[model samples]
Target chain A: MRGLEKLVTGRLEGVEHGSGVGMDALTQYRNSVKERLDSADVLVAKLVHENTVLSQTVETRTQEVENVRHQLKTLQNRVAELEGREARQEEEIEIVKDLFEHLCGVRVHKSYEDDTGLWFDASQGSRNGIMDYKLGFVKNESSAGTEVVYVPLLKQRSSDELRALQKQLPGYMFDTLSFPLKSLYQFYSKMARSLSKKIE
Target chain B: MRGLEKLVTGRLEGVEHGSGVGMDALTQYRNSVKERLDSADVLVAKLVHENTVLSQTVETRTQEVENVRHQLKTLQNRVAELEGREARQEEEIEIVKDLFEHLCGVRVHKSYEDDTGLWFDASQGSRNGIMDYKLGFVKNESSAGTEVVYVPLLKQRSSDELRALQKQLPGYMFDTLSFPLKSLYQFYSKMARSLSKKIE
Candidate 1:
């Protein structure tokens, strides 16, 4: 609209300036106008070409942005899913390690740098018939037939109480013992049969 | 350039067709040419305006696309990092659980659906001097002062071998007992007192 307004202004100026011109001057004015129009036409064609190319590029870029946005949404969901899985897995490791240490009285040393045997040094804690056992766990490889397990059962007691009992009772002795899981099953079954009826 | 070429073509045609023209005919031709020039000038002005606006829009759109691409790169890296963390956490859980089950001879059941206590039932395996204790772990809440832990030590042996030994040796016996972690430390230290006086 502004360009059109400028055109109107130019026409009004032409009315004021172009009055009483000779025929030769009119011929000259006509030539000048035609040359100006020629150059303007050329400029217009170039502008049209540039605009066409720019419009196409913008359209393509906009589409790419939309596609990337969609991809971003999918990736966001996947990242959340993986994060949830990781937190849960970390919690499980912490729980199992805590329970193992609480029950066995030995710190488990697991090095992620290497994946081989799982071990805890019970050489320090083995003491009595009930709390004097050493334990170790071997990995079960695919080549192995069955998952090997060694279960040891011992009771929890206070060190101070045991010391007090020992001072009162002379000539008492306790020792560490080893037995397979199956031995425990048989031993307990036999003992259960001999349980005192009064205690039951 | 092609628009300029068309102008040249029109001028050559004018030279060929406008020969021997009178003043009246020339004036009529000039006016007609002036009208065409006015319309062409208007079109040129409109095109220049459109091209300026289009160029500005394209520049802004290009900058937006660049910014979006940078954000996409950052998000992609975050997704990859989370995935790596998840994989490592998963591997640690597998390693810990496998080892715990192998050493304890019991499957560990961990439920991540809730966050509270950690538990394992050893009622089935508690028997004998070597493996007759129960083990359970409680979470260490910040509200509590100390992480309370109970430890028991038991040995491993084959049940069939024990049965055979019992049959061969009359009045042989095996039994389970309980003791505290501190008691174990004292007892083991004392036993280290009795380790073969000759073996050294």
Candidate 2:
């Protein structure tokens, strides 16, 4: 009976030892699982944070691009307005040029010296008196106002004759006049008429 | 002895059942972890795909914006070019107009009737012989060539006198001459000299 009791006690102790080892294995497994879960949670959180930053960056960049587009639209409108004004100005210039050409019956030429004036040819009722005419504005040192200079070809006429003629024509102030075209024409017409009457 | 055997056997069976239950619980936990890992993998793949597509969309939109910027630059250049041309043309027109006014001795006015011409007053040496001159281009139905019309005030002159005058002035073609100003001036000058000689 003593030998049988010893064997049974030894078997019970062995079972108890086996239960202790099983509990330790379960504890180790639970620790490993907890660690894996913690790591996964950290990864998900990092990914979510990165995604939020990227989305915000996209929104900011989109707003900046929209602002650039608006600026481009405004510039386009300004360009169109300038082009329209330029076209109208060009048309106005053409009309004025055509009118001048038709009325004067002459080809207009820019002066060789500068772009400030124009030069042309005129005749006094006959080829015997062809004149090269220059029409321009001049500023005198003593004068406050600009004067219109109308120089007709006076190769045959003396300075005395020119002075007398200027005196006879009320508007001429020594080849310069306030009124340009009208005064020049009147001076020539009066001279012609006076010369004609002298012969008559 | 029988009672002791029953106690040991029952305890052994209880331990086996507890181990079986622990194993079942561990398996259930493992399966749940595996399901979570699979769902996370699917979510990661979806996010990666969306990121790639978004990146490609950003590239395309950037290219579109760049294209618009290039177009805007080109338009701006064109506008500047047009404005420059318009300014130069305006200056040219102004010079031409000033030249005509100075040479012609008349006020240039646009005819209200048509865009074909301008009107001005002219004189034949005396106020008694003032003339309304029409200087214009004419295209006759019967003629293939365009003619320049220079109609002078012929109020007192007879048709017979005009025909004789036209014959005497080699350059006159019934007041329609290829060279308007020179021919008209020559004809008038010859008449004035002839009339002066007659009076003398």
Candidate 3:
């Protein structure tokens, strides 16, 4: 009976030890699973933060691009307007040159120099046919190798005709040759300004 | 004693009920935390996907802008080149016209409706030996305003000298003679072609 009692006690102790070991294993598994869940939560939170920052950065960049595009379009329009103005100016210059040619009995030569002026070649035609025409500089001096535009002016009476007129008119024939050249420039400027205004 | 034992049993049951309520509250809290974690994960994933798409779109838009800028620059350069070519062509045309005038002893007149080729008069000698060269175009087609352009083909000769030459060379002499007509046109065409080639 004694021996049987001793054996029973030893078996009970073994069972208790096995139960404790099983409980320890269960607690360790639970702790490992909880740690994995917490790590996953942290990773998702970091990703979310990073995504928010990237979205804001993209928004800022897009706005900058739009602003740049707007500026570029404005610049293009300005350049086009300037080119149109330049073309109009060139055409106006041609018309003015033509008008000068038609009005004066001298040839108008456009200088490529820093100054725009009129140059005359008085030594032309036959020896007996010496052309007498007055030429005045409009803007500047003449330069070598400059392209000169020659335009023959209107038909004016000869010196002999003028002398005949003077004899007939007598005292009324005073030399009104000396006129202020500045007035001519002012006249053309006024005409051009009026035309421009009309056209606008 | 039986009543006292019954009272103690009721108190123990109350303690067990309180423990059960606590366990239920813990379960509910754990479930709420799990739901929140799942929602956060979904939101993070969606944001990440959206950010990736936005980045790609921005890159594509930037490339398009660069391409447009390059094309605009190319177009501006082409326009400048065309303007330069036009200026050169105008210059070349003027040169050709001048050459023709020098060779033909004629001047081009841009009249309103009478754009026909005519003659220029070398008006010789006024009363004071002052003469002029006059240019006129055919206005009426009745030769009303037309004059004669005397070409200096030979050395200077007087009227008596020309009469003597006609008497000596009677076979070659003709009235209202117009020689070098075809050769003059051919020369003009050749010169024009050369000038055009230079511009090209």
DockQ of each: 0.20, 0.13, 0.05
Runs in model 2 deviating more than 4 A are: A1-95, A111-136, A147-200, B1-28, B59-67, B70-74, B77-95, B105-200
- Write one digit per residue (lDDT tens) for candidate 3, span B87-117: 7545533442332233222233332223554
Candidate numbers sorted by DockQ from highest down: 1, 2, 3
Give one digit per residue, the lDDT tens place, for model 2 in B1-200: 22322433343345445736354443444444444445455555566666666666666667766777777778778768877877776665556555444444443333323454333333322222223345555454456443445666566668775554444433442354344432433444543343323210
A1-200: candidate 2 lDDT, tens digit per residue: 23322433343344335645364444444444344445445655566666666666666667767876787888778777877877766665555544444433333333433454333343332212223345555453456444456566566667775554454433432353344344554444454443333210
Which DockQ-derived CAPRI band holds candidate 3? incorrect
Q: What is the TM-score of each predicted model, taking all chains together?
A: 0.48, 0.48, 0.35
- The residue pairs that clash in candidate 2, if any, are A125-B185, A181-B105
lDDT of 1 by residue, B97-197 (tens): 55544444334544323244333433112122122223333344653422333232224447763453344322312332234433433332222222212
Q: Evaluated against the true chain A, what TM-score does chain A of model 2 have?
A: 0.48
**Which of the two, 2 or 3, has more DockQ?**
2
TM of chain B vs. native, candidate 3: 0.43
Candidate 3: misplaced stretches above 4 Å? A1-25, A105-200, B1-41, B64-200
Tell me the TM-score of model 3.
0.35
Docking class of 1: incorrect
* Recovery fraction of native interface contacts for candidate 1: 0.42
